[model samples]
Target: MSTARFLQIHTLHTYTAALLNRDDTGLAKRLTYGATSRIRISSQCLKRHWRKAEDPHALSTLAGYVDAYRSRELVTEKVIEPLRGRHPDDVVNALEPEFQKLVYGDKADKGKKSRQTLLLGESELTWLAAEADRLAAEAPDAKAAAKAAAQWVKGKNVSVLAQNTALPAGVTGALFGRMVTSDPGANIEAPVHVAHAFTVHAEEAEGDYFTAVDDLKKDEDDSGADTIQETELTCGLFYGYVVIDLPGLIKNCGGDADLAGRIVHHLLYLIAEVSPGAKRGSTAPYGRADLLLVEAGARQPRSLAGAFRRACRPDVEEALRVLDGHLAHLDATYETGEARRYLSLAQTPLSSPEGSGLERLSLKALAEWAAAQVGTGADA
Candidate 1:
């Protein structure tokens, strides 16, 4: 068992004129809450940005981390392609269908079409390639090879095979989880619960009209813009919430408490520093959280989104005050005495209720404190 059952994290980040996330029709995403419209960023978008971040705090940079591929072409690209020239064409061709069926079940296409994208770790893919090669070499013809592979699949246990891999679903899958409906055993329950971030107040957005000029055109030429378009841009203070299930995370990392601790540490940085945006070059959307509050406790986690239920002012200090007030209300009603630590960049710090020992620390110290709560001091 871990020291803490859950680590609840709440953050307030402000962005300038940038389209952080967009709808299908190319407009800034919005959600109506408390009977008011607010700019929204999906949890999926946040997870993707954090998973693929290239910064020093990126999960991919962790030691012993394996890459995972989520795609429809996983069998072809990772399993079959590597074995194509190395083995006979007939043998290689025969293994594709059987592997596809093994992975995607009865609905799998014979010509390498998957019912859905499969998320597989590098070790699992490597194992499949080796298994295909062995089955192919033992068979007399393509027909025999296919039969042998299919028979092998029936007799084997995929989940067991997956567990045997050095890293089952890789770092991202371990953190964000993966769903393989074909095989429930392959599904990993996500330990990190991310809420869709929304603006504290009403949406503040505008349509930005832009033109693309043809640099090669001379003054004598058409003297007109090559292309013109409009895009939606919004600026607001977003409230982001995330929950870490310590026991779940530790189990997913194969009982490595130290590794789990490091993961938590790096994840804190990713959440606060990584900015999810649409147009990077044009928007240059990047900002760190102005206020970060972390709570460690053994009880179920709750979000501070109620702080913005009535829509506070755009200022960070106002948001903080509202947040503190809401938290106090929850404490008074439920008496949930969760150990709390916070970091703030605002001129006015968080005002905790008297006798509620809420320690304020810097970002580095905050992350370190979270890692320690998970029972380790190792660098992320």
Candidate 2:
């Protein structure tokens, strides 16, 4: 059977008044939701947190999935150190443009050494580094070497690497993908859709007023505070959603369903467990999801955010009723029969269609069900 077109994961989490993500002026991030104001966490913040939360074992299990390198400096560091040992000083210096242009591409500005940072997968990186070594062996002149190098990588397509169906899957590349501004052929569309998390109920941000006293100047004349500042914070339940394109995943992994399954398992855990780390020292807003909904099906994806269009209080009973209503409306409007949903929450479980046959599964059981539907989520 064909896997679902998309994997949608949603959560509702309650956090205290400590700040999570900060804005440009060092205030807590906020956005308008449900016709009211609500605290917001950007998709970038969530993705970054997920990337950092990965353990060595988790990465290793994803089939040697090295994080994509978008920095020319970092790429240079990886490419140059190895060459320094074998090549002459002049040759090493000359090879920079060859490797840079080959891996990256022609620069936008005429005189720049390397183009803008582009996403290069593990396989692409390894291949480029090997090609650099080959260029050194083939010629001695920098211009000739660069010409040959350009010819080598410029013709390669990102989709080909994306559709690679081999082992040691390029995890980050296969999912997040890479884009080269100068080369359209090297652009790989990201298969994962990330949504900015926003509060279901809108609440105005409150400022925490405080002052720090100076330790040394404790005299009666110097009785004033050394520092006085205000920091913004919000307290509310937030809703976050992420959807994965199943066919896109298969294409990205080159039809490696087993690898995709492992990645999905790890990704779900990451999304559920990781919290945005902003103002960690003073305003550490650490919270966990009170309700998690993980679903897989061939039906077109939808969000339950509409349930809070009028905004409701943080009452469990009220929230449940609203969620059920929105979901029912969605099904009625779409008549999406090929959908499967699973829910776990703190309140009384809604009967039958209230959850739309969403079986309440344990974390382990949820992963198992997803694996059974697609492929084995076995450890690499």
Candidate 3:
């Protein structure tokens, strides 16, 4: 209902971490943001950490974070194997026509496995198997079932039909999205865009030499460092930004507007609380964003990360002052009247705009407010 296609989200965090995310060589990832050098973490690394995390607040099968696993074995492992002996004839035959087109599109191959396996979630897989089961039970024979499946595949947009019918197992598809490389038609674009996290100030990467002894060599007479390696590290306040496109999310999910909103709610909490697992054993760089700000509106989304281009002194008062000035400048230049809400959580002091209509909120309250933003837009 928001009429707008996107809900941009951005954050500024200061961390006291030591080598939070590192490269293959064990050096911290680095980037030049706005102009100055800064510690950095790749978007891919951040996403992998989120998907693999098991925290109560993070997405987990036990916690009911709706998701699917993409694999060729979905036809066998998820469906056929689970219902083996229960169905006569090859079970894969019963589902190929129905699932292949939806997942593979023009590159669909009935007898062969997908060139690139789709990471289909359990929810979608289960739904597909259930539909196949119904057909297997209804059809007089395997040949008949395959025939019926072919007819089922002839619907308008089989990809949309298969997914739209089943509420996605979780929010993964809606938030992170998917792309079927072999079949562009099966691609589901991700609504959220995360920028590489960078330090707020200019800093040079430092190398630390360290030694690791193998437990097996611990009692050996010649025992020395089994492995000697140098690792790089950097510590400082960092700025990270994420933009969520609301309407684009709905489109990817086949018009499930409510689901798009729910995914945002979960992501709001997940992004702030989660840390990338770059080098936990050697450098457990762990810290949460001390300052978080959420701004919602119909205005064109923009990142204020450039605010750190010059590298300001590390002080809470000064940081907030700079942010306030940037916000003022953006407001004056852009017809930002499209902005409807501002929710902020700050550990340090922040001077409020005299009458700018900004709401300072706790993190939980902010997430709740953001969760409810779906249906309400400029018209609502």
Candidate 4:
């Protein structure tokens, strides 16, 4: 077993004439660093793309993986809907309010049909459905069923009950985490941490005014285009960062170091290959990482975003050079004993300072090497 506690992955990817992420106003997201605006992509957006990608390396392909759902109607769809025809209508209907009150707050009113969305594991939903069925079968009436459910809510533990059905956390919950405001025991702390990606240089965008012409327009009709619109298109070289807590990942996987290792391997592939974008039909925004760097160490993870505080040139070589200098400075000051591997598409080889311990490797080798660092504990 390796003695590494943290695995950090960093990448530099460039996209052209694409709108990857947008705000409510239909513009590219931006972040101000060093008093200059930089195009940005949120961590949430990046994770969604990676998690939902239908590739060979997807997390859904892992053995013993349970699917997870996020929705405001978890109780309605999973519990109440399944029991509608199987049990008495009144008994099943009574569960909605009780379950809502349990999940939301005691004062959750019926007037608001849409509540805060929640992430629930498939096992947890199955358990809830089974409980509803049992209550419907045993209750003499809806009132008794409601009272019994309230009592169950007051006494029973959700995490314990869900564990019987299947893996309660699911793969996504085990990696990204789940939050239950009313039930603290159901909450899972995310072991994988993601940072928002931003361009290394100042923000650059263009206003694209476009129109679609109707194909069946009559002759001499002199009609205008069928539709007209304008959007913001941006070209940028973005720097992305992700960190995996080895011990926390193993704990989330029920102390299975092998499973944690497999997860890390698959996640590394997704990070390097997945493309996050909006307006896919029009923009066709897709790009692989220009540089992929993986680091393994026992120290707490730190982001290298500060290297771009002064905003490097848009060229990948220039950005990488700036990063190399910053890394040398950090190593000199902290003496962090981290093992590093990287793959670069640049023309020149990466220059690491003496004793920096940075090695060059292919993406496949880098991913495997990082996964091999997963162990049971810090002292493993």
Candidate 5:
């Protein structure tokens, strides 16, 4: 019987599952290690889990990999043993090949069964049984043991393990006691959440901005001279917040307030171009203003609600006109083929209670109405 060398490996499955179940704000808080900037999951997670399925082989392989590392004696003898007196870098480099072989072995022309059953029968069985035994041993009583043994193993703690990995400089800012970084250039922080995405869905039409503007102007005045004289502008308003990992920002910027401000501006500009709207205070109101933030909590509720209420002030008709003009300007400037194509697609008219109109909309009212529209559209 071949004796398997032990290794200690940590898995992030449980942490990821917890993150996935959490609300965006909660997730942002937990993941942002103290940076002012928000961190999001990399494209890697999206690709991996988007279509992943449970496979017995994969599960068994993971179990074996974990068992090999869980043994303190084996780990000491195999891994830490070699590093006792050696430099860390040299030790890591030397151990890499051996670790790889243990994790993933080459099996040329081997039968599936033989490859699947790499460890001896007794060893494999021991590996599988140890997980249950460990839980049982750790429990305070028999009842607790039984319950714990039945609970599925979700592997080691990830946040703790990730702490062992060092973050790059200028990537440690605090958001509610958690660390986050806003240094756009720093890439050490693991992307564990996605705050926003730029796809075909948020774009607008090429001529839609101009058309909307022209229509709004024409509606205001039927006089042909006034219509022709109105400035033909194109623009859109894209609103969203880039969660700055406050700690990370401080770390990168060395606590430079000016640099942090620049970073915020740059990120806002980037997100704005993706959506159809001129930035806030830059142009007239578009059809609707989207508030995009890494977490919903990032919004200053009183201030935001006040702004929306002010937009609707004077009268609903005036507000709509303002919104139209703003949206038109945004579309004209940032209307890429991607955004234009998305706008060209047919959309259902918003379904509302009979006689619902802008006149009835306060900031809070508008938000509620918009929420209903989204819910109905999604259901449809």
Candidate 6:
């Protein structure tokens, strides 16, 4: 007789649920069954199970079996239970053992059972149906309904990493850049520059770096009959992080693999804009580059805001020049109409003199005029 090998499908489900809720710290304890610890598998492995089991006629693979069990529980509890006056026996049977394993074990064993319980119930299915109905009711047409559903599934996570820094209100629009990567074998669109510029606050340590730059004095030298003057220079270096929603950017770029490359290249440009000492082709002494491109922008913005505040206008302008130069240097770069658009925006005036209500104005008017000129030059 052949021996039957049983892989713990329920245990896998419990672990997956825990992972979704970011409960990795207690995963080992949460997944224990009998005397043996359940083998740890990645969320990627679980995703493979879902893909393989998606076909209706697909054989009873481990993932498919788990998915079927989950679907039936949702239907029974959400659709059948209230109508039939009884809960599904299988739902309780499928969940109770794992509940006991999690709840009855040691202090370490008590993990995210409450979260797992919600997954096992009809709530998700109910919510999905309700959402679909709400969309249908609210949307003007069927196309709008479909669009809403598409956006809901492709929802993004946007974060602003502005910690203890006081940024000019206009900085918000300049910092809004996307990050994305190309799909395998996809042709990359030509890269474009995306500038991220800011100034540092006075209180922060990183802010001190820029203030030192501003305080540099001019040097002068005279020889024979001529006089010469030179301005002192300061090297500004600060640390900061840019938060991005990679998946969202990919969607926004219309799911084009080529466009995704451009988006990612643009993000790299933004990072380089803020970190002058960090170059793409350059290696640091520690074998690590000065700039760190963090995925999901996980680091807290508060931790980085101080460093960002140290970035003065000159530093930002220099960074933008570097970014533009890098894009022009790319051998395979393609013209994606971004450069022309940027140039047009940079040249366009914000408001006319009449709009400013200053036909014959004072020094404040002249100051505003000078500031506008500076702003246009900085953007250029």
Model 2, which residues run further than 4 Å from truth?
1-3, 55-64, 72-74, 108-114, 137-169, 211-224, 338-343, 354-356, 376-380
Order the candidate numbers by TM-score, best to worst.
Answer: 1, 4, 2, 3, 5, 6
Q: Candidate 4, TM-score vs. the true structure?
A: 0.94
The clash numbers for all candidates, in the given order, read: 0, 1, 13, 0, 70, 5
Candidate achieving the largest lDDT: 1
* Superposition TM-score, candidate 5 onto the true structure: 0.21
What is the lDDT, from 0 to 100, of the residue 109 in candidate 4?
43
For each candidate in the order shown, give its overall lDDT on alpha carbons: 0.84, 0.67, 0.64, 0.83, 0.26, 0.26
RMSD of 2: 4.1
Q: Which 10 successive residues of model 3 have the least lDDT summed?
A: 161-170
Q: Give the TM-score of candidate 6.
A: 0.20
Estimate, for each residue in 1-380, the C-alpha lDDT of model 4 and write its tens digit.
Answer: 33688888889999999999999999999999999899999999999998899999999998877888887777788888988888889888776787776665565545345465678888888878887889888999889988888887775554554566435667888899878776688788898999999999998899999999989889666678889999999999999999888888887777778888888989988998889999999989998899988888878888999999998899999999888888878888988767788888986567665554678888798788878888534344
**Residues 35-86, model 3: lDDT tens digits:** 6677887887777777766776565532334566756555656655655677
Per-residue accuracy of model 6 over 1-380 as CA lDDT, tens digit each: 11111100000011111111113442211122233222222333323232233333222221212121122133234432332223233332233322222212222124334222212212223443344345444555445544554565342211111111121111111123212121111112211212121122111111111122323334444223233333212222222223333333333333333333333433332322212211123222011122232211111112222222223332333333333343343313432111110111122221211112212223233223322221121211
- The better-scoring model by lDDT among 1 and 3 is 1
TM-score of each: 0.94, 0.83, 0.75, 0.94, 0.21, 0.20
Task: Report the C-alpha lDDT of model 1 over 195-261, residue by residue, as the tens digit.
Answer: 9999999999999999999888878758889899999889999999999888888777877877888
The residue pairs in collision within model 4 are: none
* Whole-model lDDT, model 2: 0.67
Summarize candidate 2's per-residue lDDT along 8-88 as a digit string, tens digits: 787887778778888889887888865688788888788767766655325445664555655656447666567777766
* Model 5 misplaced stretches (Cα beyond 4 Å): 1-239, 243-248, 252-258, 274-380
